[model samples]
Target chain A: MTPEQEKEKEEKGEQEEQVLVLDAMKRYRNGEIWDFEDDMAVSDGHGGGENGVLLGLDGGTTSTVCICLPMVPSFSHSQLQSLPILARAVAGCSNHNSVGEIAARETLEQVMADALSKCGSKRSSVRAVCLAVSGVNHPTDQQRILNWLRDIFPSHVKLYVRNDAVAALASGTMGRLHGCVLIAGTGTIAYGFTEDGKEARAAGAGPVLGDWGSGYGIAAQALTAVVKAHDGRGPSTRLTNSILQALGLSSAEELIGWTYADPSWARIAALVPLVVSCAEAGDEVANKILLESVQELASSVKAVVERLGLSGQDGKDAFPLVMVGGVLEANRRWDIGKEVVNCISKYFPRVLPIRPKVEPAVGAAWLAWNFFMKECYS
Target chain B: MTPEQEKEKEEKGEQEEQVLVLDAMKRYRNGEIWDFEDDMAVSDGHGGGENGVLLGLDGGTTSTVCICLPMVPSFSHSQLQSLPILARAVAGCSNHNSVGEIAARETLEQVMADALSKCGSKRSSVRAVCLAVSGVNHPTDQQRILNWLRDIFPSHVKLYVRNDAVAALASGTMGRLHGCVLIAGTGTIAYGFTEDGKEARAAGAGPVLGDWGSGYGIAAQALTAVVKAHDGRGPSTRLTNSILQALGLSSAEELIGWTYADPSWARIAALVPLVVSCAEAGDEVANKILLESVQELASSVKAVVERLGLSGQDGKDAFPLVMVGGVLEANRRWDIGKEVVNCISKYFPRVLPIRPKVEPAVGAAWLAWNFFMKECYS
Candidate 1:
């Protein structure tokens, strides 16, 4: 084809994609098209389901999830589990550090919009919103997010903002903050809280800051091994062939091009499954990587627990240790999460491990309920 | 200022900068304004100096350099030292993997233009051109570059394309392609060639694929140590204070923002000197990082040497080991280069280390001379 024809074809393709996206957005906004939320709709008489909804956002480097829940004022912590999830929505990264402040804010706003719209609710129906997002290291970050959230909802709506790790902790503890949470997804971080509200954290500085237990870090080390083996700098391992074939590459040299072509942390982290598979197959190098990752992850939790005194003065006091994310959730024979718990148990014998039944976004919604109730009754 | 006014001011500043660059380009083309080349202009009687010139380019990730040398048909290899550099030019990155293909080509072309113009020479007077560039891993990369080089020069002019590591090796060997060369600047790679022309390379896959002997890798590890210390995961070290002050950061949390802010490997690699300083000051963490880097660097060289059989069956055959880049030239109290050499010497006792007096651009020029002469005489 001529250059003009090629240009025309490209433009047509772009236009079609844009139209499809717009149509999807329209259908999504009209959530009446989906029966998932409608089937779960309840008419509880305690001014819970129909009276109001809570928006809980867990914004991370990989993706942002918003969970809309009925604002049920549970008298006991166990009752919180029964709260119906009114609507759920997902979007791309909302971490201010990864995506700039404007983009991050837009993502948070759009996800909240989608959740509320899906539940056939509006901003006016939102009783409270808790945005627990990654990259919220400072009070300034918290206040900035809160200020923008104020712009989205009415002044009467209650707002609570915390680091995304807080939501992960709350997820396993049924909204109680007095526990430790170890998240090992594309990145890793350990955060802990005491009964009296004191808090401490370890890791969570991203891959460059040496969160080696993270999926990104584990996969990167695996890739490095492939390179070293091909170049004769390291012992030839099964990983070279395993990773090369998984990536549809013929040689280890091509891995370099494949890596930098798109330096997204998630893309590399996606290879964590293959690493696990290799380790399960008894590849020494892959097993070593997983073992090292477990140690690194346990160290993060230990650091947080020791600092926050979660295991008490005698170090035998029982404390809930929330395990979250893909790396931790791997239940294969070479289970990274099980190994991490075992490692942690050596230091804190009373470490009570909990794998949350719900996701972190629901934990955020629970936090919204807790914060709103405390303000109203206390 | 208002947004519109601020944009206008920014546009105005950009225009001024563009004008200055254009003016500099004009002055560069009118290289007669400088007298460095004029003072060395010799009219030798053998159609050597006044007859023609050779162009050599060393294109790297950080920068690209072009060297212009008089085409002297020297009888002996020792006579190559007497050849005077006619002109020299520098430009930004020309690695197509780092930059796009068009931008890399433009930079190469412009730098060549600058060198020829500075030496009061034209394409017609060029006897040969040798381009030694980074990211030339495949034969396809070499062919693409050669095709473009062909478009620029006359059919009579001979051209050669090679990986940037070849120029580095040639630099220490004085244009010979035998023995091993190890470069550990922002990245690390060991490349070797046998007397019979069998060549091999190790590492140079970059930081992701484990060039941990690199300046970038050393610095990144140091940063990780600081984060570990701050988060209570590792032992306390002097690197925390030293690196934080060097980077003008207030806290460990700030280091995360500082790191991903730019994400340029060179920017992170710049911290290598600080890490060395910390090691010299008796910081154990810093010392360990350097020691590991030493082993990594030495391993790359050993891999290349053993693969090429630079050491004969007795394992004591003499071979030139070319050491290049800032990491090797540190000359610090805790010398990394010295340690690497010491490590490699245990395996190959007759390893002769040579630090090149001339830059790689000159080596590229020497390569041009070698290529041109061989074709004419053979």
Candidate 2:
């Protein structure tokens, strides 16, 4: 064998032979163990029936650590059954600055260690780990996370880290290589990838810049509209009453208090659907707001398509559009999806709508597996 | 004479022989006062006779005082000079609460005393004192102002007080009793009197309630549109750039400082015309804002007409609409006045567009004269 092939074989053998001493000791001592195999299935067609392995870790803005061992093509059912999944929410790690990311990494490592101990696994037994986190956008950020992971885990374990948005997109596509995904929860953004490896993005520049058609946008509109209505300068929409009721506010001064006191911009954004409901009920003011929102979202999509040069022939029919966000998914009845699809179809004739199939954690795991499996087999 | 007629005769004689002490004192002091008999003409056929008297006072939100004078036929051509019209803008007299109104009355009393001292004559020498003031529609408030005026002035002096809006309307019509007049400087309101003495009003609730199509309204719309544009959620308008440039602001954060530090809502409202200018220059956003403002104003007029029950009535032709206010008067190039006229004409076929001939203060004086000669007489 060539040197590279020998090295690959050694790595594969090492992985196969690896065992969690803690789990084996627990079994020998007759300790209780929970198995995760029921949640995952492995294909039996490759590598002389050796099960493929994957490890995913999601470090989100709100939640800290989520670890999963997903089934791969080569892993047997019994092997999968022996593994365990763990999720731990790290407390208070939402810093957008540099120091915050460092503190988050330390917390992630500690959580992973605790989760592995609970699962009766040793650090050496893990073949790969992927971390999906917020603010891991730049190459330097990725490197910091990877280095931190290497320092915590055994050298044999490979590490991959990416932004949470990437994982979200991947989860929706179930590992699909090409598609567009829109995330509209607290904030709104659209991202898409073409088959030719071109990528485009729009909105989601944070709360201050863009994030149009999101909960924040909706809340802002509702608030402004209420003020206008109160002043008798705007059409009297049902949203005025609804918002006042929702906030339990009687005056604009009360609203100022709510806005300034521990403001959950996302929570405020959640009131958007109520406005939409009023609009659907034929309230002119509410309808105007909704129409404006629709236009904003359309503009975002158009911007992405245009930016990616997806308008011309080379970009057509190259990717399916996928939407995977709490707001967009929850608002299926509102026809937001239909509106988006129609808008996109205006420019891209062969637009295909695909529902996301996998959780973002699974995407992270898939990415880890792809990165590490190639390393193992060379 | 019977006791009642004798009392009436006595009151009439007193009113006819009395002279405004302030006018007489100013003429005596300034050495420019002409002899009343030599300079004044006899009754003109059109409303104003030599014996016709007018007392005009403008009681603004800022101050309260009176302009007491006798009217001569064709006084516009008369060159009889007088002291700078007795004017007062009493500080600390805003009627936000009932207490403020009481305080304003006390202040007005003091102001009247000061004016009386300047007049250098007995209080009984004043024939009439007319007050034009920002008035509350509530009868109690109206009675409060009138009672205060009566209490402050000598019982022999005929006292009259009406809203500044009435004064403005009278000014435009040269004391004509019927016509629509729009007041649109810092705030906007439309008031009209029908031939049958019915009154109609629109807008003019204040900056917080309505004031649609006024300077304040325009500024508010422009600021809101610019903020929306900054978020990429509003239609792109030229106002966005122009506003930032005018204010010397780079971002929305700078706007917060302006809002919080020395926040002058009226100053912000003044930016509307700049936005209108941009719209006229072919900025889509500016154009949209201007169109919306025009629509709002038109709607206000429509509301007034509806409230007055002028629909399907030939009497509508009798009260030609008059446009006033700084915006309407300043922006002659814009078609807002023409558009309003056109809109009104849709409802009233013979809607005449008449320019206001006198100041609103004159209207107040006309009301005062009417009260002295008619309502009080009856």
Candidate 3:
């Protein structure tokens, strides 16, 4: 197809996606999605202090971050912008999918206690709590989390729980709550909604089924390459020496024992930079790993865009492509982001992927603000 | 390099390797290596009854096999050939690298008890007990194993401990106490000795550091390819469907959870037939996986042959390339054995690879016989 025809086709698809989002928004406002007042108490605006605060948490596969900040009313854009981060704390992984229930609970509670301690806010003073966890993809997941987290706050504090992708998208679009969020950290998943409320996801099944372009995925590849070289089944690469040294492992044999014994996704993810450096130093295997990773991430973004019928949208008309997670962040120095840009450019030339302006905890705060403000306005 | 030149170079390398093995053997026989009647107790020729028996155990990464038989003396080669397997029992993994110490010992004990029950013999009736496990490579490992096994055997029973590779070599050569054994079971490792008694190994570190062409290795490759296909980073393969189905997992994502929860190298290796079938059905990825696996096994076999200076030895003089393990057995139908033979033909045209005629446990029994006979003659 000619570029002109392709552009026209893309515009039509974007128009369709916008319509889907709008329809979903109408359904949501009509009380057709996500809640009931008895199970989840939302916007019971009467109880919180005058300077009502919302605790926002972004719980990732490998780590969790919590931020306490004052929540403002719906109409105040400047208030949303200037809202101070009262306290911020980071903790180890709390995702139930990755860590067991007890570990996840401990990490979450630790971060919550730390944040509350820093902010000096009593349970009564807290107005709302929003936790964006990577595995909170279903209503059942959210409800389980709500029950678990109820002990951390006063009975009246409105609780919001959603997957981290929601906070990620909110972060890039300033809490508009629609558009794509592509995550390539310890795990990889792309999720988003059109303005019309049509939500979709691509990838994010984790390392077993999917999780392409994730740090774990990259590390797995580097390991496979190293072993193949050792067995004389694959080409030689400098990754053999660098990966072992970077991980502080004496021999490659120790990795299985270490991984299975403790099971740390974050530690494996931490090896991405070493791979990136090797790629930069012209190691073919490393370069191949990066290229494949780039393709996986781009494909994830494209999957969401296509599912939302927003493929080939013009740069101006395209949904904001929010990129988050350590893998994407690590590549900021390796020209990989540019490579990512180029791969997705065919389907999204008018769009550009950018990291969140604020930390993910702050992004969760923005999601809380958006949730409450939408309630007040509706 | 030309084939003739390559052959010549391989011969020289083999000569060097053979010399090294001879030197090590000399040192061992001179009481300069391993131990002197401490951790390992060789047959003192003064144990139990006149019709004393031996218990041989082959402890693999995933499975354990125990066989009990009468130990005929040095002059009874005919008796050795006709000796029946009195009892045999299979148990769970006894590899310390894969399972913890307690689990390994429990498995060993369980299998031992089961075999003894079937044979209708008391622990005292067993004059010698020899166990060969895959992961017990170092002298320290052997020492630890010796200490662990002593509690299971009667005080009068002579106990010998060595790695499983020794038993594999023994099985192929009918207890020759020399030549190479190639194991491609749940884990991969090629081990052999020169005629002069120099022992060496290539690969077999387990899935983390080595074990290429192992069942675990093949499974890892299959998983990687499937996920890559799902994400469009690799070609599509029948493996994507076959592997999931074989594991009773609906999606690839569940494999990570399945693997981490149970962590069975043998379970993963069990997928080898499915991969082989897919390759037979013309799945490019599956075919590629098999081809690579074939080459790795060949390379492993070649490593041992060269080290023992048996590279070009023909007929009876050639080092027996003993192929053991689930993988080698599985390939009997796939002509993978033929493929393997072809790969190694250049270096060892006169020698051929063969599966053991007897069970690996029987090989352990043979090792016990050799140990006792060596004591009697020396």
Scored by TM-score, the top model is: 1
The best candidate in terms of lDDT: 1
- How big is the positional error of residue B126 in model 3, measured in Å on the Cα after superposition? 7.6
Model 1 lDDT per residue over B1-378, tens place: 855575578679999999998876665455433333344434321123555998889999889999998887754566776788888999999999889997898789888878877777777678999999998988999999999888777899899999999898878887888899999999899999998879999998878888888999999999999999988899999999998998899998889889988878989999999999999999999999999999999999999998889999888999999999999999889999999999999999999999999999999988888888888866
Q: lDDT at A152 for candidate 3? A: 56
How does model 1 do on interface RMSD, in angstroms?
4.5
Query: What is the TM-score (0 to 1) of chain A in model 1?
Result: 0.84
TM-score of chain B of 1: 0.86
Task: Write one digit per residue (lDDT tens) for candidate 3, span B1-378.
Answer: 855575578679999999998886664344232232233233432232367678899998668999987767744644575777878989989998779886787678778767766656666567788899867867898999899677656687788899888888888776667777777767787787876677777776556444558888887788778766664446778998887787788875566567667666677677788888998888899889888988888887776666567654442355567887677777445666677778887767667577878988898988887777776556
**Model 3 in CAPRI terms: which quality?**
incorrect
iRMSD computed for candidate 3: 16.2
User: What docking tier does model 2 reach?
Assistant: incorrect
Collision count of model 2:
18
Where does candidate 2 stray beyond 4 Å? Answer: A1-293, A308-337, A349-378, B1-84, B90-170, B173-179, B183-244, B249-264, B279-288, B311-316, B354-362
Candidate 3 chain B, which ten residues in sequence have the lowest lDDT sum?
B31-40
The digit string of per-residue lDDT tens for model 1 on A203-247 reads 888777788999999999999989988888888888888889989
Predictions ranked by TM-score, top down?
1, 3, 2
